[model samples]
Target: MSPLIALRAFDDSINSNSSVDGVSVVKIIEYVVIGIVVLSLLALGYMGWRHRYNLKLLGEAIAHRKEKHALAHGRRTKDVQ
Candidate 1:
């Protein structure tokens, strides 16, 4: 809605016609549904982004452990312990 329309709607008297009141209940329901869908998508994107960071950290940890293990045990001719 335009700024002028918003101001007009708010300035209208109590006895005057309510632009919002004329709006259909279904339209309100549709808005609610759209809001829910948008929120859900945002949540999904956030989760994916967070998990990517977590996976990167996990990979670094694994590499660090492998390096530590190699350092603790000198390289042998055979891969066996």
Candidate 2:
């Protein structure tokens, strides 16, 4: 082949290879971003679940206190009889 033809072929090859590399790099970045988002969401969900559990425990404790007070009051009244 002529020198000019050989140079043209080399340039075309380089361009195609660069384009492929660029696409691969973009795909890698996309996957990384997706992974980060998923992890953040999971962390937020766990925190929310923990907060709700604490609230439930607090409510149960309050209910128990009320019941105990009522029982104590009833016992005092009976003893006065």
Note each model's CA RMSD in angstroms: 8.1, 13.8
Clashing pairs in 2: none
Error of 2 at 64 (Å): 1.4
Per-residue lDDT of 9-56 in model 1, one digit per residue for the tens? 555533444347787444455578779989999999999999999999
Backbone clashes, each candidate:
0, 0
Candidates' TM-scores? 0.63, 0.53
> Which tens-of-lDDT digit does each residue in 10-52 have in candidate 2?
6555544543545643344456777998999999999999999
Who wins the lDDT comparison? 1
Candidate 1 — what's its lDDT?
0.70
Q: Top model by TM-score, which number?
A: 1
